[model samples]
Target: MSAKFHWVLMVVFVCGCHAGAASIAESFTSYKLVPNIVTKAPANVISVKFPSGAVVDLGNELSKPQVALTPSVSWNAGDGLYTVIMFDPDAPSPSNPFISSFLHWLVINVQKDGIASGDTIAEYLHPYPPPFGDIHRYVFLVYQQRERLPVKDFIAYSTIGRFKFSPQDFADNFNLGDPVAGNFFRTQFNSLKTDKLF
Candidate 1:
């Protein structure tokens, strides 16, 4: 084979491998949970790192030390404004999820990079699973917006009740098409202190 042909083949092989790896990673239950609820296919993968330097992976069990502080989130958004939402779909308890999908945090007009460049529509709420609650999935979803949304008109505050949260309804209300990126981590009941940011 010609040298140039071999080079092209190598590049294709590498890209294919990378894509395959991403596909496998996104298949985890934690990753699929968001899409299943939102009725959209997952896109970009978010990288979340806690203050203690622990990296978040699909379904990884995190305790108070791992979730006490808001983790740094980064994702690949080519351009345009975006929105970030972090919520727990297994609120109170999984078996009896009467108040499922409690909103933890919300930000609007996030730049292509991440939350740091966005407007804080809702302040961050640290994860605090009830002592008797089952393992909860805290999901972070990023959506590319058609335009800057009138979020303030919709939500008065970030710490709203868990009963009213509906990811699908939120997306439809704001015309936020399918999510551009998403990630999640699991946390169970822990004895460590859970402090409020305020």
Candidate 2:
């Protein structure tokens, strides 16, 4: 990929796979962000964008049929990339209230700014989901950055304050306990950095 255009990642994972049951009828499997999700790309600037149409209503949270806005953004930063993350805080969880879970909906990276709408040239990212799980809510968020941010792992910090993680910190945390954390952490941390678009 040229510096002007690089591939971003979009990912999805579910829970039912481990539960040993088919996905819930109305549960959210995954979500996708398309070019149409954004308003428009700049002319002189080659930029990547993501789906910002997601809306979270505690009343009626997101499900499989109800797609959340997938986050897409520029990767090289020169052309500009956007990253988005969408999740359900109230997703149907087990008895544990604090032990919140996350479902990855959009872990995609757009190649260029002018990719035609409905074009599937983009890529999809699949994190870990109980081997064959299904029907899980993933929060989709988008972050815009100036370059491709590389990380080693994913670290779960409830807030940004506990410890402002650099890309490296994130990479390590994700993989520390969950063998599946490194790959997912790398992608998720990259998205978080792009969020500092100013």
Candidate 3:
């Protein structure tokens, strides 16, 4: 291949990759997830596909996830243990999320790439934004664990009320550091939602 042609192809590939990354970053910032839940936008976008063929895309407004079990989460990161946390930063109401960051799911000791075999710290709670509330952001964050989080120590996290949970504090206590990959979707209360828990 001519050197000029090879260079042109490389440029196209590079630009394509950059645009994909930029979209995720822009959406996170647009939805305020950058400053509210995470200090920085994660470098990778984690894939969250639900059983009902629904995929969670950054900043997209979704109805209920269509399943009670945790959605399938996958990421293309290094081989090692990982942790996944899903929460709502806008609990009760986005304008007044006093009980902010209501935990929806927590899985630790996740093998690289998938959450199917992970230890479940908190079973997935179907999203049910309060009837009177505005849109809510359901965020999924994947952290590369420096070491295996001791199962016994994290078991109590499930028992603790899901409300008033802090993903930042949990990461700090466990030394999980910043998330390597993340994605979020916006949802709001629908009175006609067939899956309403309340």
| Per-residue C-alpha lDDT of model 1 across residues 1-198, encoded as one tens digit per residue | 899999999999999867844763455443557355677645567788889787777667877666777788888778799888888888778877778778888889888876787888677787878879578888888888998776666565465544558887888878897777777788887654443331
Candidate 1, superposed: residue stretches over 4 Å from native: 1-36, 192-198
Q: Residue-wise lDDT of candidate 3 within 54-82, one digit each (tens)?
A: 88888777786353446888888788899
Residue 180 lDDT in candidate 2: 14
Please report the candidate that would top lDDT against the real structure. 3
> Better model by TM-score, 2 or 3?
3
Q: Can you give the lDDT of residue 85 in candidate 2? A: 33
Ranking by lDDT: 3, 1, 2
Pairs of residues at least 3 apart in sequence or in different chains that clash in candidate 1: none
Candidate 2 colliding pairs, count = 44
Name the TM-score of candidate 1: 0.83
Worst 10 residues of 3 by lDDT: 189-198
Total residue pair clashes for candidate 3: 0
Q: What is residue 75's positional error in candidate 3, in angstroms?
A: 1.1
- Name the runs in model 3 displaced over 4 angstroms: 65-69, 196-198
